[model samples]
Target: MEQAFGLVHHGTATVGGRSGITANTICCDVCIVGAGPAGLAAALRLADLGRDICVVAPLPGDGNRRWESLTPGAWKILDALGLGTALAQSHCLLSHAASVSWGDREVNRDGHAEVTFLIDRARFDACLMDAARRRGVRLLTPAVASRPQKIGDAWLLPVTTDQTTVSLCAAHVIDASGRKALTGSRRHRLSPATLALCARWRGPPAPPGVTRIEATAESWCWSASLADGAHYAAVFVDPRSLRAARDEPATAFLAAVGRSSPRWDGTLASPVTACDASASRIARAPGLEDTIAAGEAALSLDPLSSQGIQRALVDGQQSAIVVNTLIVHPERRRIAVAFHAERQAEASRRDSAMCHGLYREQATTYQSPFWSRYCGQDTPVEHQLRSPVPLDNLLPETRLRLSPRARLEDTAVIDGDLIALAPALVHPELDRPVAFLAGRSIGSLLARAFSGASAASLFDGWRADSLPEGTALELLRWFWQRGLLVDSSATDAS
Candidate 1:
C-alpha cells in the first residue's frame, strides 16, 4: 500500500478568493493540515509506517507567529520524535511548583512538578517541520486547503498558494488548523471569568532560587524567569476585573495583583509587555464523514491545568494509530469514531470543571461585576455552579502505578524454601522502614527476582551486613525518579 501527505502554509492564499488566487492540485493517501507538533507528529509517525503523507502549513514568515508554553509531555513527544535533546538545550525547563493563593488560603498547590516548558512557538514549529522533512514526509508550505469536496468515496482538497492553486485527492483528511480555521458550526465558548495576558520581557537576572511565583485575586498573576535570564509573566483575570482596566491594561492588572499580595510588586516593572487574553471551551465533532479533526481544531481545554500540550501530543499519536488502522482494516472506522467520541467527552468534562472551579474561587474574594456574575452570595448559586464532575474523572486509564503495590518483609523464604529468612528490619512499626537488614537495594532485588531467576539462587550468596546504610533508600529514590514507583497519596485513589 502507498500513502501521501501534504502541508499547506498559513496566510499564503485566502481560501475565499479574496486574494484572486487559483487552487493547486496534488494527490496523496492522507493529507494533514497544520504543521504544529500534533500535525508534524502525525505526519512523521504515518511516514514511518510507509504511508504517503503531506503536511501543509504557512511559509516561514513574520505574519504567522504564535507564542505558547508547553508542558512536560511536550518534551517527551518531541524526544520521541528525535528532537528532545535539542529542545531541552534551547527551552527553559520550569522546575518550581505552582501555587494558587486567594485571601489567606492557598487553594491549590502542585509540588515538584517539572512537566512544563516555555518556548518560542516559531522555533518549535520550525523544528518539527525539519524533523518531518528529514523523515520523508512531503511538505507543502505557502498553501491553503480550501472547502473540501466529496468525490465518490474519496475527498478532493483544493489548495491555494501565492503563485498557484493545486488540487489534492486523498482518502482521508486530518484537520489540525486549530480554532481559527475550524469549519464546523459548533463552537466552545469559555466562561467570562477566564482571561489571560502574556508577553516576553528582558529584565535583571531573576531573583535566585525563584522559578515562578503566582498571586491570585480576582484573577491570578504568574511570573517566571526564562532560561536566558529574561522574564515572562502573565496575568489571568476575570472579565469584570478586565473591564475596570479598559483604559490601562497592564497597569490595571498589575495593580489588581499588587493589591492582593505585595510580592508581585517586585516582579511588575515598567515597560512591562502584555498581550490580550481570551478563553474558550472545548468542543468537537467526532468525525465528519471522511474528514477528521485533531489537535486544537478538534477540542481545546482550559489552560489552567496545563494539559493543552499533553492532550495535543496524545491526540496526534492516537490519530495516527486510528488512521493507520483504518487504512489497513478499512472496516474499523467505527472504532476510530468511538475513540474520538470518548476523547471529546473527557475533554469537555475536564475543561468545564477546571474553569468553573477557578471562576468560583476568585469570585468569592473579589466583589467585582465579573466575580458577582459568576459567583455570588447565594449558596445555591455557588453550589450549583460547582463542577458537575470531579477532577479525577478526567484522568486517562493507564496501568502505570503511582505507588508500589507490593510490600517486602524483613526476611522471607523464596520458592522451594531454599532461601533463609531473617528479621532485622529497623523501624518495623513505621509505614516506611528506614532500613532493611538485607544488604541490597530493593529495586535491584526486585528486578533480579522478576527476571526468571529464583529468589533463592539470587540471594543465596548475598551478605545482609555488607549492604550500605542508605542502599534501600537510594533504590527507592531511583524508582521514584524513573516513574517506576509512585507515592500512594499523591493522586486520588479513585
Candidate 2:
C-alpha cells in the first residue's frame, strides 16, 4: 500500500492507483461525506458512470449497534446494488412471522412471512463500504471534512486526516451524513420530536422466528429474537418524557417497555441507547447548488415505518442520477434539480402519510401525546380502486373528450439512469404525472382528445402505435378512472 497524506492506496486500486492529489489538493468529480450505505451507494453508481469519486468520513462500524428490519423492498434495492449475495451469506436472522398489536388489543399477523430479515446495521455498513472500495471508490477513512465552499464550479472541502488537513476539491458534493447533515441548509420537522430508547439483551431468545410489535399509552415497542441467541427491544417516546429521569435512563426505558408490552423485558446486555426517531426532510431543494443530500441527510422517517435503510438506499440511487445528469448535461441543470426536489418531496409526503396512518390506528386505543402528535392531519393523495367509466360496457362509438382539468406539461423524468425532460400528461385528478401508459405516449393520444373522439376512432388511430388489441381502450379507461376523460354526452348535458 502506498501512503499519500496518510491515505493508503491499494495497488491497481488507484484512480487508475494513486491518491487523487496534486500539490496536496485531492480533486475528483464528486466528494461524498459520510461512508454509510447512502454515500457508498452513490459512490458505486458514480463510479459506474465513469466519474472519479471520493468518500470522506470516519471509519465505518463506529455507530451504536442497532438492528433493522430488511423488508422485501429493501432486499430488491440491495440486489440492485450487488449486495444481495452478501446479505444472504451474512448471519442475519431470517424471521418467518411478525405480529402487530395496534388499534386494538388483538394481535394481527402479517400475511407475507418468511421474507423479512433482521440485520445488524454495523455489519451491513461494513459490507457496503467494502463493496464500494473494491469497485475502485476512493475512501478517505478516519477523516473529518469541514464546511465545503463552492469556488467556481467546484466544491472545496477541507478534510482533516491524521491530525493534518488536506483540501479535497470536486465538481459536486453529496451529503449522506445523517440527520445533522453538513450540506442541506434547513430541516423541516414533519412531526413531534420523538426519541427511541432501545436496549439489547442476551437471554433465552423470545420464541424463534417471530417479531412482536405493540403500542401502549406510554410508547410503542418492537422486540424480536436475534440470530445470536439473544433478543432486543426498542420503545419510542417523546423526548420531554425523559427530562426528569435523565439520570437513570435505563429505569425509564424499562418502565416504558413494560407499559408497552410484557414480552420486551429481558436481561440487559448493553447500555440503553437513545436516538432521534422523528420524521423530517430537507427544506431546501435536494440538488440545489450541485450539492445533493442523500439518505437520512435528505429525509428522515419514523422508525415505525421500518424503512430507514430502504429510504437511504433509494436516496442514494436517485441522487446518483441527479449528479450524473448535472455532469453530462449542464444545460439541463434546472431539470435535474427539479426532478430531485420533486422526488424527495413526493417520497417524504407518501412515507409521512403511511407512518402517520399507522400511528392514527393506535391513537384510537391510546389517546396520548405520542399518538396524538403523529396522527396525520394532512390527507394522502386519493387513489381509485374501481374505474368510474367502465370500458367493457362502452360501445365502440362512445364519444369521449379530455377533462378540462387535464393538460400536458413538460416534466423531468427518469430516463434509464439519467433525468430527461419529457412532456407528461398532468391533471388535477391524476395521482402521478403520466408520460406513457402501456408503452403508448399519453401526450400523443391526449393531443387528439381536444375534440370529442369516438372510442372506435381513437382505438383505430392509436393502433398504428402497434399497441395490443385492447390496450388502447385500457389506456383510455386509465384516464377515465382518474377523471382525466369525460363523456361527450356529460359535457353536453352540463
Candidate 3:
C-alpha cells in the first residue's frame, strides 16, 4: 500500500492493533489532535519513526484564507519532513524582502537576503494533511476529540465524528490544537492584548511574494499578495485603540489599510476575518510534562517577528523527535519532557522580548498610548502595564538541577565573548541569559558533571565549595527560569 500524502511509510502492521488505522474503536501508538502544519508534520514524523498515528482535525482549517509568508528557515524544517520540495512546487508566490514602514522610516528589509513565499493557509494545511494520510497515518476528520484522560498509563480519547464516537487508546497523545491547547493546556497572553482584522482583496494584481508592513500612531498594518492572486491586508490593534477607530472591525481595518501605504490604497475587499494576534504561552504546569503541545498549542509567536511560521515548522519537528525518543528510551522520559518545556518557554520569552524591542524603536516617533504600551510605558488608566518579560518567576531558594535534556555546545557569550556551556535553549533572542552564565562559567561545570545535582550545590561549587553568593545564584536562576535547569525535587523520576 502507498503511504498517504507522499510520506515515506514503513511496512504494514506486524503487531495486532499496534499499526491499526480505522474509524472504529482503535488502538495505536499515538493519537494526535489538530491537523495543521504542526500536527500533520508531527504525524508524518512519528509515522517515519514507525509509530501508528491517528490525527483528528477539521479539514481545510476555516479556509485560513489569510496570506501566510514562509521564510527560508521554515523551509529547512519542512525539507526534513518531506514537504519543502512539494510546497515549493505548489501554488506559491516568492519574494526576497518585505516593505517595512515603522515610525517615520520606511525601507525594504533584507532585500535579496532570503526567499520568502506567500501561501494560503487553507491549501497549505490541506497539502500537509494529504501527505499525512498517504503516510499510513489514519485520518479522522469532522471528529472532535474530547479532553484526553490518562487511563492506566495510556490516553483514552473519545473522538466524535459524524454522530459516531470512537474510543481511541494510545500510549502517547500530542496536542497541536492552536491557542487554547486541546489537551487541557492553559495560555497566558504575554504581549499587550491585540486583535487582527483581516480582509482578502482582488485588485491591481497583488505583488509577487512582497509583504508590506506599516506602523501608525494607533496600530500597525500588514498586506501581502497570496499565491491565490488575492491581496490580504490586516490591521492589528489593542481593543481600546480599535474602539477609538469608531467603526465596525471590517471598516476600521479598511480605514487602517487605506492610509497604511500607497500600494494598499482603495484595494480592500470582502470575506473579512479577525483573530487574536496577542503573544501567548502555555503556563508551566505539572501534567504538561506528560504530553507535548506543538506549535501554537505550545507558544504563539509575535506577528512583528516575521518568523512565526518558521518557528512552528521547526517546533513541530523538534516535538516529534522528543516524543519518539521518549517512547524508545522510557528511562530518559524526564529529560525529554524537560527539554520540551525549557525550549518552548525560552522561545516564548524571546518572541515577546523581540516584539517589545521592535515596538520600542517605533515608540520614539509615535509616542501614542498604543505604541507607549508596547514600549512598556503606561497611561494613567493603564497603570499596571509593564514589559512583557516576567523575569521574577524564578525564586532564589528554588532547588534547580542541570536538565538532562539541554543541548551542549561551545558558544559565544555577551560577558566573556565565548564560553563552553550549554547556551540558551533559543539562540540570538535569549543568548544574553547564557552570556551572564558564562561570566561564572557554571554551564561548563554543569556540562562536565551533573547527575541531577542541586542548583544550590552547583552555586556552592561555583563559589569554590563555600557558601553560595547571590550573583551566581541569580545567573543560574535565569537558566532555571528558561528550562536549562529543572526543579530537582518537583520531578518525580521514580
Lowest summed lDDT across 10 adjacent residues in model 2 is found at 8-17
Q: In candidate 3, what are the lDDT values of residues 300-404, reduced to their tens digit?
A: 888888788777776776677777866776776665666667667767766676677678889998888888877673311212222332446444455665555
Instruction: Tell how far residue 3 is off in model 3, in angstroms.
Output: 18
Worst window of 10 by summed lDDT in candidate 3? 412-421
Off by over 4 Å in 2: 1-23, 61-63, 110-114, 207-209, 283-290, 376-387, 390-397, 438-440, 444-476, 492-494
Q: Against the true structure, candidate 1 has what lDDT?
A: 0.56
Give one clash count per candidate, in the order shown. 32, 2, 8
lDDT, candidate 3, residue 40? 81
Ranking by lDDT: 2, 3, 1
* Superior by lDDT: candidate 1 or candidate 3: 3
RMSD (CA, Å), each prediction:
13.3, 4.6, 11.7
- CA lDDT, every prediction? 0.56, 0.76, 0.68
Q: Per-residue lDDT of 1-494 in model 1, one digit per residue for the tens?
A: 01133343333333322342333445577889888767887888788878898877855543313345676666777787677766655444554545456534664435565546666677777777877888888888867777566666566677676666766667777777776544444665544435665544455565322344354445566656655565566666665554665646666655655665554544543344444344343344434555667777777666556677677776776677677766876776775656565665566565556656666766666666655554442222121222222323222222223234444445321211112233322221222322232444443445443343322333332324354436544443343343333333356442
True lDDT of residue 92, candidate 1 = 44
Per-residue accuracy of model 2 over 289-389 as CA lDDT, tens digit each? 46888888888877877888887888898899999998888898898988888877777777777877777778888888778876645646435344465
Candidate ranking (TM-score, best to worst): 2, 3, 1
Error of 3 at 259 (Å): 3.6
Stretches of model 3 off by over 4 angstroms after superposition: 1-24, 59-64, 109-111, 203-206, 226-229, 243-246, 284-289, 377-494
